[model samples]
Target: MSPMGIRLSPLGIGVFCLLGLGVLYHVYSGFLTWRFSFLLGSRTGDTVDLRELLAVSVKAAELGGVEVKAVRESNKLNENSKGKTREGADEKLTRGDLLSNKKMANLITSSFPGVQVNTEEHLSEEDKEAVYWNRGIPNEIKEIVKNPKFVSSESITIWIDPLDATHEYTENLVNYVTTMVCVAVNGKPIIGVIHKPFTGYTAWAMVDGGSNAKTRASYNDKTPTIIVSRSHSGAVKDVTRRSFGNQTKILSAGGSGYKVLSLLDVTGNDQETADVYIHDTYIKKWDICAGNAILSALGGHMTNLKGEDIIYTGSDGNEGGLLASIGMDHDALVEKLSSKITSK
Candidate 1:
């Protein structure tokens, strides 16, 4: 007789506790993925800034168990015409509805005042409050604010892209859109987090951290795969074609942030995911910073076409092209490309 209930064997009690722990873990993981996925999903729209984040969705999509409305055309313009009218889209009063890059920048600075943040926009006080009230903040970020000891680095730098792949987003390629945040220490990336709003896929990693399902990438095929921009291809295509020739296969994608993660896609299993990522076009720092961090955390490599490191300075522009790979011989690849293309 244990209290008012029948007594159980010691082994039975241990088994029950383990089962309880497992259930608790499952619930926590689901809730985390759902919250972040929904946060990213809610702010996705055709235009810039100003959005009201409710359980509402203009597109018919399910994220983390919540039903979202399908994204519909605003009807102000037709598909036949390429037009954009910003005559009266003022949203000062409804600023809280949007998840602008400024808002995210403000929140990160607030969370870690000691750490430096480099973002695309200049953040004001109002933007900080907007993000806080709108639930755009993350749990791990909040925890880091409370416990600095959780991260080993004495000093850290943050790079944020509130929205990546705007071209695809405007072109109705919803699945390619992503929200990225990367953390670096001593000018080296240590943490990478990527969230796909429409797909409800959130993957994160840390350098030297324990491995997860997406940690490993393998190439067992005879033909190597390379991912480049879907929309912008000319110099990269011609240069790479002449460099690698028909020996390697090339694929086009939308976002630079997402392209780096494709190296770790794991869908083709560990054996068939992409092997190399190259871009000859101009790439802003915010575009690939997070993806590069995530790739580095997973033991991948990224450098300029000259085979030099592209330093991460969040606000400024970068020189030369990029070469990123998962466990591939980067220097050898660059040596082959250098013969065909000149490093800028």
Candidate 2:
């Protein structure tokens, strides 16, 4: 009787103590794992501050604008055709496109190591030595988003269109050109930045972070104005006429980004504003993601002709055609065009 308790060998006591330590170690490790996951925004999908992402995206877009402007001013556009598109039109590419793509990608990747950046241009060895734009976010954006909110970075994809409207740029239609960046999480665009190199104007919006752009007044005219691509105008014009009557004002423009901005009254060329933007063929995700995010932020809508949401995560193109509108009924517009528009 060892002090009126069950007697145990020193070895047994040693083993018992070891087991207790092992259990404590396991519990401690699990606690640490949970804490780590929570901090990394894995546990709670709402852990990442979108403002930080917005700031980074704006900076990247500005840098991209710099590259685009530099190449154009240098008079070394070096335009080349990527190939004929599905519609059998020559797809244009230029030195500005590649250079801007490189600058945008490098900045976003370096700033947020965990983010995935998707660009429209492929880089060459010469792009490796491209000068990076080392600048901070504009104060205008900082003042827009004051309240702190978070989103998960797990499925975040940053879409960068280094130079939108390359064809227009080569043809000296620089006002239609832009450098765009869109922050999409899990296929849904939440942040968008459209920077005009030629005009020195930038428009950015985060889903809930706030925006500098405002929606224009509703199109009250019986015959609404619709903007379409300069290259893909034939099909859209026909369908739009059929859907909205022959009196619909149809304007032709280059760059999907420019057309979308026109809907918001953010035109670089001071051209006539349009009520809607319609595309009757396949368009790339990078072309529309920023616009989509901006419109969504302003309580507008951008979707396929069927009124379905455009996904930005996996595929590169939206084949369902486009119908983007602001300060009007998006569903009604979709209903008007969905059954009539034909995609090629």
lDDT of 1 by residue, 1-344 (tens): 67869888999999999999999999999999878545443322221111111111101111211211122123121223223212222111111112335545655444344456766545656656422233342454333333222433234566766556655655556566666666666667666666666656666655555223254436532356888877655478778778777666887887776687678764532122467788875566667766676677667788888888777654455667788887777778888888788544
lDDT by residue (200-263, candidate 2, tens digit) is: 7888999977999887766644678989999866588889899999877888998888888888
Number of clashing residue pairs, candidate 2: 0
Mark the regions of model 2 whose C-alpha exceeds 4 Å error after superposition.
1-47, 124-137, 267-271
Clashing pairs in 2: none
Instruction: Find the 10 residues in a row with the least total lDDT in model 2.
Output: 38-47
Highest lDDT, which number?
A: 2
| Local distance difference test values of all predictions, in order | 0.56, 0.83
Q: Residue 213 error for model 2, in Å?
A: 0.5
Q: Which candidate's TM-score is highest?
A: 2
